[model samples]
Target: MFFALSKVLGFFALPSNLMISIGLVGALALFAGWVRLGGALLVISVLTLAVLGLSPLGNILLLVLEDRFPKPAENDNRPVAGIVVLGGSFDTIVAGARGEVALNESAERLTVIAELAKRYPEARIVFSGGQGTLFYSGATEAQVAARMFESFGIAPERITLEDRSRNTRENAVFSRDLVNPGAGERWLLVTSAYHMPRSVGCFRAAGFPVDAFPVDYRTRGYEDMTRPFRSVGEGLRRVDIAVREWVGLFVYRITGYTDALVPAPL
Candidate 1:
C-alpha cells in the first residue's frame, strides 16, 4: 500500500507536475468567471517554475542531500562481507523489450558495484529491487541487474538477487534476510548519493549494519550554485529528485521505517 501511495504522491509532488496542475486549476477558474483568482494562480505557477528552473535554489537543495554522505576513501581497505546495491539504476522496461540492458541516470550505482566486486573478490553481491513501476508488467530490476553483472564477469554463484522488494524499506528487510549475515559481518550499501541517508537508516533499522557506498552524484559541489542554469529541464529534474528524497526521509522517519531522518556516518 505504501509503495503504491508513494508512487502516486511522487508524481503530484514533482515541481513540473505541480505547476501544470496549478495552471490547470487556474484555467478552470478562469473559465468559471473567477478571473482574479485564476490570474493569481497562473502567476504563482509560472513564478514557481521560473524560480525552480533558473535560480540556484535547485542546485543548493540537491547539494544538501548529495553532501549528506561523502564517498568512501580510495585506500580505505575495509573487509566487506557483502555488497548490497539498491535498484533504480536500470531501465527494466526497455531492457525487457529490447533484450538489452539499458541504464539510467543512476547507472553509477551499478558501475561502482562492479568495480567493488573486483576489488573485494570475496564479498557477496546482492541486488535488491523488484518491480517498482505501477501497471507496467515488464522485467524486474533484479533480472536486468543479474544480466549486467554476469556480462561484467561476476560469477553467477556470487550474485544474490532479492527481487521481491519494491522500496528502500523492503530492500533493507529483504536483502538482510537473503544475505543472513553472521555475527560481526560487514555489508556495504550502495545507492545514489542523495539516497544514502535514508538507505543507511533503513538498513540500520532492519538490524543490518552496512557501510554507506554512495554513487551517482548529481551535484558537483557547493560551487555549483555559482554557475548559471545549464538547462531548465535538467535543473527542474534535479529539484524533483531532491524533493522526492527529502520526502522519503521524512515519511520513512515518521513511519518508523528508518532510525533517523538523516542518518550520519559512524
Candidate 2:
C-alpha cells in the first residue's frame, strides 16, 4: 500500500500536477479578488513544472544520491541459524492464483539459501515475507518461501517461517520473534545489496543483530563502471535506490531502530 501510494505521490505530486491544480485553484480564487500573487505563482509553477516534467535531469540527481548511500558487503561469517531472505521482487517472492511459486534471480539469494541449507542441514533456514499485493487473502511471505523450499525437498519441519509481515519492518520484527535469539547469537540477513542497509537497520531496531549478507548487487564491479557514457536511466535508478537507503539509514538511526549505521565493510 505504501509502495502504491509512493507511486501516486511521485506522479500526481510532480511539479506539473501541482501546477495544474494550482492553476485551477488560482482561477477559482480570482473571483474573490484575492488573486494578486496567485497568478504569478501559477506562472512560475508552470515554467518550473514544464522543465522538470520533460527533461531526464532528475536522473542526474539520482546519480548523486546513489553515491551518497552506503556500500553493501559480502560477508564470510555463517550464522548459528541459517539466513533469512527478504522478498523484494515478484521473482524473489510471488505466487500464482493457483498457488504456484517461482524463483527469479536465483543467484546470491535464493540459490545461496538452497546451497547453505543443503550444506548445513542441521541449521534452521527461516523464510521471511508475507503475501504482497498479489494475494490479499492474507498469506505471509514465509508461507510462500516454505512451499518453494519444500518443492526442493526440504522438510516442512526444517524450515521456520514468519509470513505475517507486511513490509521489511514487519519482516525483521516477525522473524526476530520467531528466532528469539539471545545476546551475541548471530543470524544472517539476506536481501538485495541495494536493500541490506534498511533490512539490517529494521532488524537491529527489533533487537536482533544479524550479519548482513548482501547479494544481488545491481551496481557492477569497477570494471563495469569503467565504461564511459553509461546509460542515464540505469544510473538514475541505482541512484534513486541508494539515496532512499541513505535517507533510510538516517531515519532508522534517529528513530532508534538501529544501534549502528556502519557502511559496507570496506
lDDT of 1 by residue, 1-266 (tens): 86788899989988889997999999999999999999999999988887787777777877887888877799989888999999999888898899888899999999887789999999999999998898687789999999999889999999999999989999999998888988899888899888999999999999999888888888789899876577777778878888888888999999999999898887
Question: What's the count of clashing pairs in each model shown?
Answer: 0, 4
**Model 1 quality (TM-score):** 0.96
lDDT of 2: 0.61
Q: Which candidate's TM-score is highest?
A: 1
Candidate 1 local Cα displacement, residue 199, angstroms: 0.3
| Candidate 2 Cα errors over 4 Å, as ranges | 1-79, 91-98, 102-108, 132-139, 223-236, 261-266
**lDDT of prediction 1:** 0.89
Most lDDT-accurate candidate: 1
Query: What does candidate 2 score on TM?
Result: 0.64
Per-model TM against the reference: 0.96, 0.64
Cα error, residue 126 of model 2, in Å, equals 1.1
RMSD of each: 1.2, 6.3
- 126: Cα error in model 1, Å: 0.4
